[model samples]
Target: MKHTPYYLNKPDNILPKGLTNSVFRSSDPLAYHQSLKNYTVTPLLKLNELAKYFGVKKIFVKDESYRFGLNAFKGLGASFAISKILEKDPDIETFCSATDGNHGRAVAWSAKLFGKKSRIFVPKDTTRARILAIENEGAVVEKVDADYDETCEFAKEMSRKNGWQLVQDTASAHYAEIPAYIMAGYFTHFMELEDSIHTLPKPKIDIVFLQAGVGSWPAAAAWYYLNRYGVNRPKIVLVEPIEAAGILASFKKGKRTKPEGNFKTIMAGLNCGIPSLTAWDILKDSTDAAMAIEDSFTKQAIRELYYPTGDDKRIISGESGAGGLAGFIALMTDPRFRNLKEALNITAESRVLFYSTEGDTDPENFKNIIRKKK
Candidate 1:
């Protein structure tokens, strides 16, 4: 049952025009993130041994496991979105959202931080550890008997009925505002890199591999890099699970598309079928290529990160968090992706970047995966 990877390169090299909006350039993200308790810049690790193994000059990984001790990067978006809403309406008491895992925990954490109540809904397959994590954040957690998309709808309906503010990252017709704020909040990490990258041996990044669930995180990264570097921006690659490659399917259709599948993957956070409209708008023009990887590849990536080569640092990456790296590894090792490697111009001299978006959020599953021998 080995599923081969897929890649689609855009014909045009146009920069993302939509990213030029003032919200991306605003100073609010940095200010808001700094105001939070225990706000510190996450580590940017240089994996030289891994670079050498892959015949690359440098491989820089932004480890977000240390983010607020949440072991994931979703807090950046959830915290900022809630703060923005509170600034406008301080009287709001309850916030609600649906998630596969990380985002819901982040939303619950943010609500607790703001002294507000939260109601979170998750798909039926969500792990017990994830549910407990959200509950620990002081949120009422419910497991909806549906997929991620259907759970989102169920949460929306309940939010409407109970008068709770929906803080979802996926944007619909009239729901673009909060999603926009959430995406803008991701600017804080890239902004930190803008300053710290100057100190690296290879400051100019040749490419970036960003993992997408509903595409919001990767879209934010794509928008930030394309806007910051203008014409000389690094090549952006969007990666997702083969079973839930919504962004890749949308890229092929020249419009927002919902991929047709069961959307089941060990990468729980990335088990999404539909792309957010806001994410699609920017990604459709900004990203260089879209790639999909099998869940097995992500398992391999997780093991690789956990067991480092030579003097490289160990990164505790979850299934979804290892997705971007999984795509890169597949392209390099699998002869099936030779054309994709060449199309992206990855070479011995290329300096690549990746974000380890989460740690081992599910401890038992992580242990079992790492213990398995292929």
Candidate 2:
């Protein structure tokens, strides 16, 4: 629904010196991920037909649905943070966090993996299926009479009072280390892609479209590419639902800011009104652009991935998962985005990459959307 260019005048090929030594840039995270017995690389799919349809050189989609068998990418952050916490405090018995859906389930799954108890707080609007998913992960689910941000505060308070570790993705002055570890854990995805880069049509990707919620995941991506490629890094675009486009609002204001929205979008995983401190710090300087899209566009993208062109593999993307591709489709097809398209240098030779962050996390909604006519 909206597009805004950011950091256009910033010089290219220069390393963000502040982030060069950050956890996201270190090899430790990737090494840690590889040490896990369950760790396996997710597929980086080539969509030649889709590239032809969009008139782009190529399109690569990282299918995160296969990650940890949790059907979402949040497990990467949660597992890493929990593992690091256990290393520091092995006596810790319980962990707690808040979520719209995916993060809480991830925390639960990670806690279970570590043989610790988990208490997950979720917004009142979270779907029943997601709640059951968290419960199935062996977490005690608490539905708060509040939105995502308020629920986060509630969970933090509960964790403090109960002597439980708060495994939240967002960072505050009092809590930065765990969030950093979580972000570092997300580096594994990029590392996996790097290993397979030799097999791609091009060794380097021209652009990357990353979907954001509280911004942690995309921040990890931006930090990785910025530190690794320096001035030659791919153009990174942040995508979010227009109703909860906190990252985009922050981009326009040139500082951290919250957005006011009805919070009824089908992209439940991206319905956060606040941006994380660590994420904002990295994204504000590193990313190329921010896009806010409507639910209709995400639905269209889900259908497009499920029903692919030619022999392209089918990807089961949820509302939030399809956001990156949704943003790409909007830029290419909508006349309103022509200027931004040109501004980002999107052309027939541009090799674009997208992350499908989830796979039908909300099964019923995904089914209904897929059943509807395009």
Candidate 3:
């Protein structure tokens, strides 16, 4: 894919000076963590037992489960993105998006933060609690067809016709600038991740398994950490749900990957069928690997984090957010991946990091299954 310049990289950068100072601090072309102070970069907890089981030196999870009241790292992205966009184009009277849950809520809430009217379109299968949660954030909520792609189509079509500023959570060439800004917002989380890494005991980013939703966050993260740390940078592993492995499949396809598909995944954030051109361009030229996991594995991984045996301080982790660790665990348990671990040199000495991207937007639904496990 030929490189079309990012908004941040453009010669006449249209971002206002105030917005640039407030959000666009990072050197990474598509990210900034200037607003990361309010949100906690949840710790990279050492999973000694899991490490031993996988025959690795160390394993850690960058629990994004502690971000603001929302309990997801996504807020960092949407909030920062919306702010800069608003600062640059304050004339935007309305903002809108299509999300499985997280991105829409974050973008809508951030829009409200800037006193803009916002709306979120979701798939029909989305939970009642999710709809209400986004609505409570001062967004008008609408439900479309069952699939995520359908919701995205609805949101885009509506935004175009109604003259609302469309904040498509996924990326596309037609309107790639916003997604680039979104990726820059996501960088703040990774920037926080870089800081948190230094505080960890014997922190060495030999491997990083990151979740993907059109791959914006991880691509921006890869750009930052790899450049900051140099060629010995961590080998990045892109994690997506099995049904939504299009990003990975697309990566291996080089420039030949199709831009359209009918993909499904239990990980709502990973439910995207179309590739974000912004993310695809970045990830294609930079990432180390792309992988996918089953929904059953996602369930177990969530339990491992939130229901740590005998520990009652329940960690608030969203279902889809835990999918990165799930994919990591799958790699650990895989016969084919055993030797690839050697490629990463992930021995007892190697350190790993994975981002927990969202909190349980629907606690009752999360608890419905979780309560039984208890």
Best by lDDT: 1
Please write out the lDDT profile of model 1 over residues 122-203, one tens digit for every residue: 9999999999989999999999999999999999999999999999999887788788889989888888897767333334
Which residue pairs overlap in candidate 2's backbone?
A: 13-231, 14-231
Score candidate 1 by TM-score against the native. 0.95
Q: Where is model 1 more than 4 Å wrong at Cα?
A: 1-5, 11-20, 198-203
| Candidate numbers sorted by TM-score from highest down | 1, 2, 3
The candidate maximizing TM-score is: 1
Scored by lDDT, model 2 comes in at 0.85
Ranking of predictions according to lDDT: 1, 2, 3
TM-score of each: 0.95, 0.94, 0.83
- Name the weakest run of 10 consecutive residues (lDDT summed) in model 1: 11-20
Candidate lDDT (C-alpha), each: 0.86, 0.85, 0.67
TM-score for predicted model 2 compared with the true structure: 0.94
The per-residue C-alpha lDDT of model 1 at residue 271 equals 92
Candidate 3 lDDT for residue 216: 71
lDDT of 3 by residue, 1-374 (tens): 12210001111211223322233354242233443445455565776665665567766766676666666777777776677677688899999999988888888778877789997999877888888878888999999875776778888989999999988756665776676677677665555654556333333667788787667777667655544654556677777776666676675555525433345455777776656766666566556667666677777777777775432234556668887778777776765555555554556676677677777767785675466562
**Total colliding residue pairs, candidate 3:** 7
Candidate 3: minimum summed lDDT over ten consecutive residues — where? 4-13
